[model samples]
Target: MSTETSAKAPGGLRTGVQKFGTFLSGMIMPNIAAFIAWGLLTALFIPTGWLGVEGPVEALRWSGSEGLAAIVDPTIQYLLPLLIAFTGGNVVYGHRGGVVGAVATMGVIVGAAGTIMFIGAMIAGPGAAWVLKMVEKLWDGKIKAGFEMLVNNFSAGFVGFFTGLAAYYWLAPLVKGLTDVLGKAVGWLVDTGLIPLASVIVEPAKVLFLNNAINHGVFTPIGGEQSTEIGHSLLYLVEANPGPGAGLLLALTVFGVGAARATAPGAFLIQFLGGIHEIYFPYVLAKPVLLVALVLGGASGVATNLIFDSGLVAPASPGSIFAVLIQTAPGSHLGVILSVLISAAVTFVVSTLFLLASRKRDLAADAAGEDKLAAAVAQTERNKGKASSVLGGLAGAGAATATQTIQNVIFACDAGMGSSAMGAGVLRKKVQQAGIEGVTVTNKAIANLDGTADLVVTQAQLTERARMKEPNALHVSVGGFMNAPEYDEVVALLLAQQNGSAEEAAAEETATHDAPAIDFGAKPDPATSTATAEGEAPEGATPEVLTRDNVRIHAGSATRDEALREAAGILEAAGAVTGDYLEAMKAREETVSTYMGNGLAIPHGTDAAKDAVLGSALAVIRYDGGVEWGDGDVATFVVGIAGKGDAHLEILQSVAIQFGDDDTVARLKAAETPDELYALLKGGLA
Candidate 1:
């Protein structure tokens, strides 16, 4: 697995911020369930909570039990720090790193008197993992072959021990001091009624995927301390506010076009009800200008809290509105509700303007046809070229062309579930429908990818990280995990490769170094020709709608029109069409580019051009350099169709389903012989 980080920002300071934010998010997001559980315990059993009831109802209240109340204290001090330590270390160096991190955190807990040990845990966890990783590198290949396990265990133990001692003597006190200073500074902000200004920092960090880090790492410890002093703290509500994210989604639901409009309502429900704030991160990323709205909305919500002086009795684990309501102080319900409403309204107004502007731009681009959209998509990918370089040597190689059948396809993400799981499910159904065998599709946390997968799919933001985790796997990044067009592309490539294996093997045997003399407008080879010796359809032969004569290898067309004409010429020679179909096909292309992702395109005439069809026929042409088919999409496989009525629709659908398997499409693209391409296409229809 590669360990390279994503491309660095232009400035060192910006790069550092990006790394810090990503690292912090990685450590806390996975342990959110634990945080929620802790919050529930604190909210229910604290002295002021429901468990504090002293009447006959006390029987139902665990707060009456001294043991239960005691449970909250250790949980707040110990459990969270331990979780953070393990997660941080695991991310850096896997399970062994987790063990060392947990061991090192013990010293920080003991030395700091358990005050804000989360800061200590963060330091000690990664510090210990780094030390252990260095030690392993130093001893790599030096340990006796049979005694590797013994050496590894003993070295890890020694490193953890010394690291713990170092934390106890030096790091703990230093971090504790810093934590105290930060706490006082925040307290001053609250006292001055300027706490809302903190949203300027918090909102941007949350958008950078640092919500979990800020809430769990920074705010939770400070909030816990404040709650102990005054029974609740507004600091807990600062980062956990769901209003800004909810507002953004609501705006998209009402005025956003395309996929955003369809997906926003579901995302809103998950975020506002289920507390999965990550759902909205991609939306903000797609249109970064909306960061302005998030920041303003967050500030407005914070201001509302300040006005009402609203505070939660405990942290809201998922930051869900329901959790907020549950943890709200007795008299702060109205204020809390108002905060959410105000933030949403602010975000909605700003987002609406941005959406309108974006819609206008999209309308102009659409009028230009798919070529503009394709070009835009291509440019976006080009911008990510630097970040994608984290794959290092694996970028253009690895499983992309590997002949070994893809045994495992893993959809990886930061948290593993949510979008990754949904993507995996969608691809799984497509794989099943395609009759793809011997392949396992699963979703895993990016850090947990073990390099066993043949292919890895992830959100573009995390592609670098995913590549680092499984460098040998073919990595494909998409805009969003749900409803991604890339899924179909990946599936097509996979199936093509899987089914084209035999053809590929055979072509290798016939490989030759000698190049045939070039002949412009040369007649087709008699052995592979579609027409009879008289330059007409063969007598008394069944029409082979897709035959060797209808297949063009490396046509190398300079434009979509040229590629379509080349393909149509093959069909006409095969006696499948009688009239000029080029104009009709070009008319269709004007309306929508025939180019689909995965380097394939289906160019056909309009319904009225059915008269040009003598019978249902398909022409497959391979363009080595690929013709530009509007926008930025290139069509390597220009499949020209001339069919009567709806006769060719099923075949078109089959072609779509076939190309959707990325492996098969890849194999098809690499096909060297017309026979090889013919077999693959015929097998798909069969």
Candidate 2:
């Protein structure tokens, strides 16, 4: 199925920038609350604050007294940077890495004590953690079985110690200098009245899902340092301004075509009020010409802020009116408001002109069922090179027009044989365990959507396209099949509808030890058509369809091509299909990913290559490191399928049930030998 992931990084410099920015943002985003806490204290207690009392408060802060103002310096100096380091390290290798990284970062902070060192923390935290990961690899399996914990702890301690010394002696000064260069460049732009030109870069990158990187990665640290010196920095306004996106959506609501026009009003409110600018991205991407409006509108906002010399005391996350106002620098409220307004007005007029010029063509295109925005949603996925959960949820925000009872739940993707199938199995298992009945859940390709199903579930990236395929059906967007919270939500909804309101079903669901709080909404029965409906399998115990002989534990396949070939070899050797199925498997993979979430991948043939099937069987393999499945995803388990009219569905369901949970995968990962792995697989599958 079309399972987009973060692996398909863009080519060359764009890829570097995007990945770097994403990595940086990841470390910073989690610590945003810390930054806000610091910002609030600074805004109220500092000399130029709203309070601006300028007497004992200033003296107390300078004296480092145990007062409200005392929190401001240490929060930015030690707390914020340390939090970022811990987060960055956690992403690399969990708690051990996090602790080491934070410890090493202390050296950098102390080395560059005069500088703010946000940039230094960004460098040392993940850098030291990465070095530690590589160092661990040198003796990974060589450690004596009994002394593993001792070696790991001592090795990490040594790495952190050296890394800390290195940071203090060398890295700190380099990062300090780098921050200075960036600061000077930004200053030059502001002085020369060229800061507005940054819109040329920021506006388009936002549409490409790179806004987080630009804001948190590059802007936040630099602006934060400036905010420490002055009360605010204009760099925060460069990327977080909501005016351009707001203007675009407003224009579309007034003069747009079909579904895009239909969804614009609600989308507008969500973008403006909630500061979710992603919902409007598809609109610009669907028609690239509209980017003109965004660039110019963003430029205007930057220009207005430049003229007023106004900026925010802290970064305005989500760029909503509320966030913007809350973080507005002292006496800059009018300037910030004027900038948002002026930018919106400029973009609305520019976008309106563009729409009018193309109104005739758009109407004609809509009449022909060419929904550009809907089509552009897929293009946007390609541009971003991965699926975003936030963007996915927006599809049904304004588009969920009707409430219908749930009976048929269709999990759709591009090819629909892989991820969708597993997702369907996941929901089916939940439905069965809940004792829900009568509902039929199945998997299908997006092209196969026929308006028969009451509910359609798809990856967030594909939700819009699925909506177009079946306009009347209710749509549910999820990040992926494995361990998606949406499954619980759906089950909860069904339980609620079958007995009471969503809130009422909470206690009923709570009695089931596995079920969490009630959040889903589906009405009544969920028989959840299992794969058994495809073709009846003979009554069996784990069947010949899957066996220890058909399983390969810890297989080493370096690349996607190798993984596909290896999977095909297992199926062929098992006599499940003729050798010709290998080519079909490759072809199928080329069309879309079979990489399901939670470290699972399923490789199977296409309909065109169905003739190669000799017997229905399944072959499972677990990669040691992970196979490089495209679109920025890694696959640990690769299941090759050769179905004779769905004879393998039962085994597929078993595979799904076993692989769908993180705890189960952890147990599988812990298996020390082939025999141990096979025994666990057999126990679970049976």
Candidate 3:
């Protein structure tokens, strides 16, 4: 929430002009073809045609109005704005339509439509922002960080569209006047010889091959038909180009996907299917310098077309790449060749540069074989146990081994870059806080680290992944080392592992040091173990076993929010997590999804957690799901949290995973329902 603005733009007026120029250039060839087609149908195909069909010559005599309608009716109108908004939304939000969201957004856009979609754009940005925040909260803030930029930039366009529209509508006349004045001033200068030299110096840069290609080769043909009013020629320019344009688009995809991994799926849907160019504007804005490359590319293609005098055979829809190629005239083939080559070359170089620059930071250490061994070695060193040999020898002599056990650990998570680092940080801190040495604490990607670690502490998706990756990790899992969990198991385990008992440590630490003795046994009556024999199973499939295979619970737990906080640690450990946890937890509290009856609070994650698990465990806790929980409907929260890997039955690993079934949930929600809920739970796991 810092109010800072960065000075960079993908393209300004110049870029806009260039885009217009390119569009105009692309149009010319198609316009010519349409003109020819109309003229032919009007002339030779009319009077002498079959089936009493008369051409323009014959038809115009009977009804010139119809002919006019034919020409004007096909023109694209306000649909243009919708197209822009759709693409813009995609670029910003990475979602397809935003149907209801977009509709709500469009009201603002409509309010500003007369000006340019500016007021709408202004409102749309904030509107989308507000809704997205809600989504982030629901998802536990896991997807928020990655999607923020997309949202901001995408929304900016709605603002800009309105702004631009306003500017164009109100300022065009003023701009035209200025242009006239400038033109006169330049003319005067040329006459006086003072400006002639300036023109000479500037003309070369302006006259690069692209201008010639566009103006002479491409623009001339379309401009000719447009001037002649040849059957919707104006609409032809934006049609999808077949050859070079397709290549350019493909290149854009590769570059874009490479830059944004998960975000790319959303972006791709907008760009390719929706045909929205504005979604890509932020990329250019991020690196304004790259606009020059696009310009050069555009200019070069235009110049090449002009040099070869290539022409389009007909107007093609901007949505169809094949149409553009098919419509090129036989004689203008050379221009087509040059256009494709120039655009592709420029795009390849610019995109390649951007891709390389973005990827330099994200490459895996194990990408090359050399780094893998080193990383593995480092990992082994950190995780390997270390203890006093004398103690070990004495224990071994007594038929025991003094093995090192990690009793306390921490897991951290932030949005994206910060989450993983934070988890690792907390782990280190917790290890130090316990005053324990040689404990194995490490950080791993939430997604990949699922079941590997003993105790998982994570922020978002890592928790989800922890649920799936190392369901086994949960028994050993400790709530976040950074945050408090529902239970203080770490403190319990630490005290247990210490040289003295809890009371002894409290006395010794209180006298010698200022630190209070950490208490882990807050829950005097441990949660009723939900694990039952495999005989009782859920309806769709067997209950997910809360064994070492599928759960990662944090050690310590906070007060009421303990389960909530622990959920994040599990998500981080599993890496199937995101969004804002606080918001998500609050919403879940309002309508506790975990309808754990029979004196249990099965606290679970919101729908945003990507993993699917049968209810992880039927929480048979001593306390109910808190009176304040979910409108007091949930006295006991029987949580059914899971990860994405459990899409099917065979893959499921916990009993709680089945709670996700709508029928089961419905029955659980409505059943008289604790006993009914218990029956349902038992039946599902039966």
Taking all chains together, each candidate's TM-score versus the true structure is 0.54, 0.74, 0.28
* Candidate 1 Cα RMSD (Å): 19.8
Q: Sorted on lDDT, highest at the top, how do the candidates line up?
A: 2, 1, 3
Off by over 4 Å in 3: 1-75, 79-299, 302-320, 323-337, 345-686
- lDDT comparing candidate 3 with the true structure: 0.35
Q: What overall lDDT, based on C-alpha atoms, would model 1 receive against the true structure?
A: 0.65
lDDT (Cα, 0-100) at 56 in candidate 1 = 27
Alpha-carbon RMSD of each model = 19.8, 7.1, 21.7
Cα error, candidate 1, residue 161 (Å): 2.6
Between candidates 1 and 3, name the one with more favorable lDDT.
1
* Residue 523 of model 1, lDDT score: 33
Give the Cα error of residue 442 in candidate 3, in Å. Answer: 20
lDDT tens readout by residue for model 3, 500-618:
44333432332222222111111111111111112122233333322222232211111355455554444444433444543454444432223322223444444433233322322
Tell me, by TM-score, which candidate is best: 2
Residue-pair clashes per candidate, as listed? 26, 11, 119
List candidate 2 stretches off by more than 4 Å. 1-16, 55-66, 388-418, 426-439, 444-478, 482-529, 532-541, 544-686
